[model samples]
Target: NRRGLPEGHADVKRMMTVPIMRNDEIVAIVGVGNKAFDYEAEELEVFARYADSVWDSIQVKRVEDALWQSREIYRAVVENSTDSIVRCDVNGKFLFGNEAAIKLLGGAEAAPIGKTPEELGFCPAFRHTWDASLQYVVAQGFPASFEFDMEIAGRTQTLDMRFAPEYSPTGRVVSVLGVARDITERKIAERELARREEQYRVLTETMKDVVWVLDIESSKFRYVSPSVYALRGYTSEEVVALPVDHAMTPEDRAALKALTLDRVAEFESGSLAADHFYVDQFPQPCKDGSVVWTEVVSNYYINPDNQRLELRGVTRDITERRQAEVALRQARDTLEQRVEERTRDLTRVNAELAAAMQVKDEFLSVMSHELRTPLNAILIMSQVMLEGVRGSLNERQLRAMQTITESGQHLLAMINDILDITSVQAGTVVLDRALHEVDALCAPLIDRLRAEAATRSQSIDYVCPSEPLYLWADGRRFGQIVRHLLENAMKFTPDGGQISLFVQPDLDRRVLSVRIEDNGIGIAHDAIERIFQPFTQADSALSRQFGGSGIGLTLVRHLVELHGGTITAESAGMPGSGSRFTVQLPWQAPPVGSPHGAILAAGAVHGPHVVLIADDNPSAQRVMGDALRAAGYEVLAALDGIEAVATARLRPPDLILMDMQMPRCDGATAIRRLRQLPACAATPIVAMSSVVVPNDRALCLDAGADDYLAKPISADTVVDVVARHLAPGRSLIDAASGADARPS
Candidate 1:
């Protein structure tokens, strides 16, 4: 080696340099000087080996320093952590416990080192669950987590616990490191959130308004309430899957899409508040192929959890409200026009209507007399002939006479029905109330109509309780009600059809129900209400097949109502389906401890009573006289009111039947004159007439008649009236005072 030192350098005889390498990089240098000889190969090799050993030692020292620094950092973290951290051996003996762990047990004095949880006096419940989790980690060589309860200080704490197996260098699980977090407040918050969610779900599920959530970006429903199905005929799941505009019409869909985009843009631009509502109305199509109007109220909001912009809304059906608005607008538009037109026509129309009504009232009054007078003669003669008064009749002759009598009676009934409806409409009809036995009132009607039912080969089934049930009503009108209802049933029923009458009296409700059912024809459901209107039938074709003025049921209903009752008609609208008419009438039982007295007593007069017949028509006088004479009574006939007074003065008859209309003088004037006489002052006088209006009946009784009878009288009615009056203890009837002299 040549000496190449600078002027102040140290002198060296021999020198060698060795490179120290670690991981293929130079880490340090080793140099030797003044070795007393030149460096040999053996000595250099020895120095190289020695340099490698020294490098190994430096690496070990570096590793030790790094590990100690890492352990100090771990200790700091474990001690400062809020979570309780501890290490336990495989036998569950505590190896170490951090400050938090010691605090969790109680304090520094209660540190868990060198003690199992049992020895440390931990709650058994927490210890069991924690120890099981630790043992599982040791056996499975994995981490385990659980939730447990531990009593710390004076309060029980809910803690989330985790156990992890600590492995040695050979991968053996030596001990378990446990960490417990106090999550009591967090658990309470989660429970409260779950409870609030349940309440929201319940409210949305039950409410009729549809609640929904829509994703702003996708324009699709994210959640929909169960009520969406009721609102739009789409299930919640189906609605959630469908686009927001699926229920809208094509035009509405396009409009709504543009509107929604504008709304979102407004929100983004900060022009609209997040809590602001967007309310709109549009028509939506239903699954049933119908369109309905809907109102949607929505608010744009960003979901806090997902940071998603969403629309929360409620929708309601507004079809009915919209329709009402349209109707109101139309009515408002036409109101002024109609008012002007009506104002112009009111005076003239009023005059015309007044004249028409006056003429109509006069026509009905005159027709009642003109029609019933001849009807009376026809009915009287036909009835007399049928009873074999003149001679015996063959079967065909009897039926022919019967047919004539029936036709005349039917005409008379039509006239009476027209007058009745007129009186009912005018609200002038008055009822003559009397205590009547229900059985007695109903039996005669059934017997009278049974022959007609027999002609059609049909039978009427009559049902009534055997007990004596009474009703406080007009007996004659009640009889008329039953007859009309039964006739209606027979008319509609086919030949061989069945009719049933059920009479039920309810004492508790104080009502009587009369149900008339027939197996003939049924009415249509739509026409059930129409049939109650005057001159309206269930079907127009029925009028052709069945001869009716269509006013029978109308009159029946009016009469029923006048008697303080209600009537209902039921039918199925099919032939052979039959019909049912039920009538409910107010019923009142008689006084409990009172005796009922008859209006007139028969058989009180010992001798044969004279009944003077006074009338203008010879046929009427002859028919009445003949019927009276056959009833074992002395009969006097007068063709006019003049002879009637004269005959009564000479004879002083026990009873007098006076006709209202007569030639020369009317029966009213004659009765006044006859009452002036002492012998005839107390005599019972009945006024008979063809005009049966309420005023007409009042007029006759006001003129001192005991009772008033309409024309077309039956022989039984005439005889019964005479017998009742001729009996003793009969008082004069005062018509002006509203006294009823007629028997029930």
Candidate 2:
């Protein structure tokens, strides 16, 4: 019945039966109708042969189908797994691309299939690998696998490709199969890790520090950087073979072992940090067998597999830095010590300066008082003699009296200089304010010195401006300054030398310049700077020839400065040249109700009564004493402090006459001591000294003396001082009393 089916149905059944092969065998059969038309004998024979051949082909295909299924399962399992998979043909053409590969390529498997390695942009190494795989597969007829680098879509990729040869039953080549995995990420990670390891190795090798790894359990070197050779004179290989403990001396080894064991225990107990310390583990011996100092930082690492601890450490030679640190510390200490020493020295200097200043003040005070006392006696006695209080004298006696007067005046001038210098040095000079007409103030001084100048055959020319120059200043001090400059010029100038004085306004600076120029011995270049210093002469010979204390210019400079002015000297060096002195004074107008009228009124008086006498020599004292006794009233004698105090106490004298120096006590000390006594305290003390400083008069006043008068007492000074200090009635009475007084 199955054979009687229609021809169409029979073909249909055949088609279904071919597909029904399972497990490589057919379990049942399906029948179809016979051919529609009756077959001839030839046709029937052809059909039977075809049917037999078809059945054989179906059975062979069944085996092939089973193998193909098995292969599909294997492929699915391999490809669907998380691993990347690919397959290529002998020519390196993609035969299959798995899910992982498709995902890596960001596409479906069909996109990569049928593409050659070149088309897929595989790198040369991959292409070569593929070719080698193909060659090996062809030769051995077996599978092969290799790692390769490929460039896919401009990105490099790493792949592990496996090749398998498909062989026929005779073992002849048929086709080749390849499985590829995209191991790009894994390869990259591996390469990065290797690179990091190489970098670490290079860093360690190049470092100045020594790096080491040791096996804790055995105390043996696991690794050491090449620099260990430089540090400890041991190669890495040699060190690795020996126990780390063996490299250390016995004492150091014991210490290291103890320290390492402790650290390992602490690490196991979770009590030790990554950082630990070890002392002198690796000592580098120098050429001379001396050891260099080193410091080590050690840490522990536990191996994951073995649970063994490794001691990894770095050793640094800190000798140089440490030495530098020591040196810096030493320098700091030294600097601090020097600062302390300097501070101490400065403190001592300050103390000494303070003491010196104190001593200076005391000395000035004492000197002023003592010198004034002697000057008073000389001045008073000189006045009495000039008044002709005794019987009329001969021409010789009158001439001698005149000499005494002149000498007394000279000595008084010297004492005044000393006081001025003392005051200037002590910074105590004061300006007495008054209205002064420049020409009028200078007139008297010029007239007085005119005769002296004429005696030298020198001409003093006064050039006054048409308009009067009136200023507010100390008139006496200003006159003194002008006179000093003029006198200086006169002394230096030879006979017939021309001296000129003139006043002019300095338009730019609003000042008045008083210039005195003379055809005199010019100052040398070397002496110019020192000329203004007190007691400094230009040259020793000049000092001797000039007969000056060298304080005139200094006093002039001080007075000018006090008046807010400046004075300067100019000369064309040496003989045959002339000298010029220019004084510049700030212009200040006099007050509306100034004392100019009073000064003129006072000038009208022919003389002053107050007397001051100062002398250092004893013979000058007797001569002065005899003159003063013949004149009138009480006389006080002070040989020294003792005599001065006794005489002053016996009678409170109108004025004190002082000597600068005396036996038993110096004049300065004597004056100070006398000033302390009550009786003589109020009396006017006058300073007299051979040695005169620029500020001596001021110094005398500062020590409580009233005025200054110099040595070699004169009759006129005595008469002048008595007239100045006495009441008008007393002065009149003394003038009359002079006729009755007897010569001593």
Candidate 3:
């Protein structure tokens, strides 16, 4: 008999004895050397049965031991795995937990065992899943896997959990084994991929050019951007299912196929890549049965896996650009045509201006020659009559001759207007300044126009400042402005109308303001602004009714502006109403070094003083000298400044009226010479000239004369100036009027 011992045990060193039993017969007994305890009969009987029974029982026990060892190894592996391992009862309470599960829970290893999921901070996201998973495990007794998000230990975690049911002998689930893995990072990666995909989709939709990808083997489109809908009216999905050639026109499709094949062959052969192909006018059919132009560019893309090639590229709609090019070409042609037309028009206009200028020059020449000749003849004839060379005339005849002379003067004024207008148009109006008394400059003009006003039964009231008003100005032009404005007022006014003139100093503005107001046929409101334009009348009827050239106000405005002043006309806008014209001129004080000899000389000449007059025209001389003599002054006569000077020297006359433009010595030179003599130096000498321009008076006065006078001087004006200079302290006329008139 053999004893069963543990596997790989060493053999016993001493032999031992045992009894054997066979078929109800006693077997031989064997004696052992020694034993620790006596073998009893009952123990031997148990051993005797095991000789057969013991061997079989030993084999069964050995099988049971191997199975238990394998189970232990599997249990250790499950307990030590990185993944959390757990076993739960049917009620979802934790029945067992490995070290991983305990560590994952971040607490003591003994804490989780026998605890419910709720006690360990495990709550199901959906309550229904708990009941379903429980029911499934109980009914099926099988393993199942599920995904869930759970909050564990104050943090959210994604879990992939597998539940395996533990069954009893009756096939009922006693508990469940669960294996769980944290999959939070995996879920985050999946979400990030989805977000990027959405971004790409949005970018493709908003882009202008069509983007597409093709499957090389199938020769069909796999991807198409949403922009294809805008360019070709084909939805992305529709284009993606169709071959690329289907979208192109037949001609373009053929060309594209050839090019694609060539590129594919080159790529497969490992040769140089075929050149990238571009077609600007590739035709595409729209959903509306219309054709559109597209620009296509493509290259061959070799598929790495199977060595297949695909044509992938973009297509842009070029219809608008093409239309713009066509329109631009047409515009270029139109611009060229317009440029030629303008050139021709300008050439014609230039020729017309040249012709007009030539005609203007010819007209001015003829007008000057014709007007001057007549004016010269009339002037000469008037001088001859006034000189007594044509014999003495009666009062009536003298008056008639005076009328003739005045008419000639008026004609000469018209001629001057013509000449001035021509010169102004030719751009030749220049400023020439001289110092003179404003009142004296305006006095002769006022006297001449007075008679004209009287003829119309009108009266003019003139007022000047009490103090002498001196100004540096162009005297002739200054007089012209006054004359034109005065004449304009008198002509428009009806008989019995009143005209008033005034001069005042404007100290703040440093200007002299001269105003002339009249009761007349006033200008209309619309006509006032245009009245100063040359040749412009208030109305065509005004030209006929007033008998004016309409250039008077225009010339007045120009002359006033030339002196750095402005003139304006204001009217009541009705016939027989009133109009006022105001002129403002810049004023400069006279130099202190200038002589006031004229003022001193006027003081020397007392009442009834002898005054000698020298003028080539006898009428002027007589009228002047007689006016002086009549006003109580003794008068002497001479033909010119030379004769006047000589006569004054001979008779020791108190004053001399010298004609400025004389044959021998001019008044300016004569006065200069006479001033050198002590006897004449203190004498009052007045120089007269017809051309009373600004410099003329200054030239005379600068040469030592007492005062300068402009011709056709009136009797009152000549007497007034002469008297003022003769006796500065006395009444102006007191010097002219002898004792026959009272001093007052």
Candidate 4:
């Protein structure tokens, strides 16, 4: 049996088996016996053909089984899917629908197989769209998608529907398979996100603080709010185009860069929390070249777009807050110093106390300048009008103009009193002493107050020496002392009261004594010294009864002390007993043959002197020009220092009245520049300014000005200054502006 030879014919000699197949399945087996010889190729070939048929049938059955299995899997997947899946015929009739589809159509009642979307109670508005999509898919043999809103279970549902053409064996589109996703919840979320974004936009746009986002990698702003213009003086687009540290100074920029690097290191090291915020304060430079302190609150976040860490910050100006903190600290320091020096000598304590009170002097200086700048125009213009410079005025107009001038002067006095008290207490007042006549000072002051007394039905009587009384004193302070005493008399005295002034000269002691008496509201004996204190009236009730700042006598006493004189106040402690103030001054005459021995008259004017008035205020320029023109001088005005320099170079002036504070080029700078010019070198330059302080005149004079004039200058002062400065052929006699021109 191991060899090719038959082991044994066996019991039956030869046998063969054949497999019978039906539909590729083995139905039966047949056996044949007594075969003659071994099968030849021809016989075997026929048998092989039958066997090949059976193999073919088996292959076909395998393919059919696999296709059926694939169909079953596809059906299972379609049924389990959450999306609504359905098939429609070319005419839009439903061929099959899954459970999701039935649920989408409201319990299968509204939608059923073999029914079109319209026939199955679909939205009428969507019916045409559905039919059109089906037709398009059928015609183009391509897939299509659309979205529509529908009602399901008594609620609105938004569906995103896709249609694909189902092809036949011949590649012809038979029906459309639709898959719809109910995106109702997704749409609601999207709408809510949009609304919240709009609300955020509104908040950031309208707020005062600037909100911005920075791209860390680019080191530039990614988004900047419109409010950036207010905080840093840059537009939103402009800021976005700039570097993040553009508004920072060089030192600040370096610090900020270092801080950012540290923050980044902290973030990468996991030492900083993801939602941590930072607060920073620094000085930021503005577009206008000014610097302001700002507070920045920021947080780090990863931008979803680039998946990179970025900074979102809110910036607000804190310059005013910083100033307030500084002021508070200064106040604390001042309080400590006051307590420490409380037991020192009176003079030393006073000087130190004055130094401590200099904190508000800067603010007072600014306020004084601003108030006096406009007031200069008002007073000067009113004076010019009253003098009939422009034209003649009727009686009514003259009276009105006089009232305006008086009111303006009253306001000026009050302002000066406030400033003078500050200056005197601070011990910063410097006297510009000059020769003055007692008659000239007392007579005009008496005349000035006579009208006010008449209005109150009061009579003011004054006695002066028949001969001119001469003394060495500051004319302005001398007048102020007398004016305050006169005003005090008028303030305390009742209507129809009598006020008297007695000027007595004692040549034996080289002293002059002046006495003023009022017949109403006498001071108490105990408060005689107290009345001379700053901001103290004789009686507390008198403050409300008579409207006065109560610093008049205080200023008067300080001024008299500054003049090397003594003043005394006497009262009888009884009403109607009257009050008397006596001031005594030791006189010193000018040296014989000295020019100061005689009052310098405004010498003769040879020619129409060309005077330049340089001021920034339009009204001030106009008034000064008119006043100079009325005084027989050719006047030219420049709005600012730059123009003044240019004008002076073009047409040289005999005298230049330059304002200290002006736009572009200031008076100090202009004067210094003008002095370099050959034509202006010898020209008389008088510096004028509204800011009245001890050092202001020095500053003006140091700027190459021959003299300085304080603001609210009367026409007489201007004329006298011009005449004295421009007297024939530049024979300089007394470079002083005027004896009466005093800066408060």
Off by over 4 Å in 1: 1-13, 19-28, 34-37, 40-50, 168-172, 304-308, 327-744
Error of 4 at 644 (Å): 68
TM-score of each: 0.44, 0.41, 0.48, 0.42
How many clashing pairs per prediction, in order? 1, 58, 6, 0
User: Which RMSD values do the candidates have, in order?
Assistant: 25.8, 22.7, 25.0, 27.0
The better-scoring model by lDDT among 1 and 3 is: 1
* 1-744 per-residue lDDT for model 4 (tens digits): 365547665555675656767689986555455667765557655665676676778879999999999999999999999999988888888788899998876566664877777777777877887787778788888888888888776788889999988888998888788999999999999999999999999999999999989988999898998998888789999988888778688778888899999998887788778778899999998899989899999988889988998989899989999999999999989987886776466678778766767657877888899999998999999999999998999999999999999888888889989999989987788766544678888898898799879998999999987866665557888999999998899988999999999998765544579999989889999999899988888778889988788899999999987765689999887989999999977553322454533333322212235689999988887666655543435567898889999999988988899999999999999998899889899889998889979999898898899999999887668767887876643211222222332111
**Superposed model 2: Cα runs more than 4 Å off:** 1-84, 89-93, 99-126, 165-175, 185-199, 213-222, 236-289, 295-314, 318-744
Provide the overall lDDT of each model, using Cα atoms, as 2-decimal numbers. 0.81, 0.69, 0.75, 0.81
Q: Once model 1 is optimally superposed onto the true structure by TM-score, how far is the C-alpha of residue 356 displaced, in angstroms?
A: 24
lDDT (tens digit, per residue) of candidate 3 on 251-342: 67878778767666777786654665545466798767678888877666666767667667778889998789889999999998999999
Q: Which candidate comes out best when scored by lDDT?
A: 1
lDDT of 1 at 499: 96
- Stretches of candidate 3 off by over 4 Å are 1-88, 94-125, 133-223, 226-325, 383-389, 393-403, 422-486, 493-519, 554-744
Candidate 4 local Cα displacement, residue 576, angstroms: 32
* Model 4 lDDT on a 0 to 1 scale: 0.81
**Residues 300-373 of candidate 1: C-alpha lDDT, one tens digit per residue:** 99899899999999999999999999999899878978887887688679888779877888899898888888
Model 2, 426-540: lDDT tens per residue? 6778666543578888888889889888888999999888766655467889998999899989988888899999988654454678999998889888888789999887788
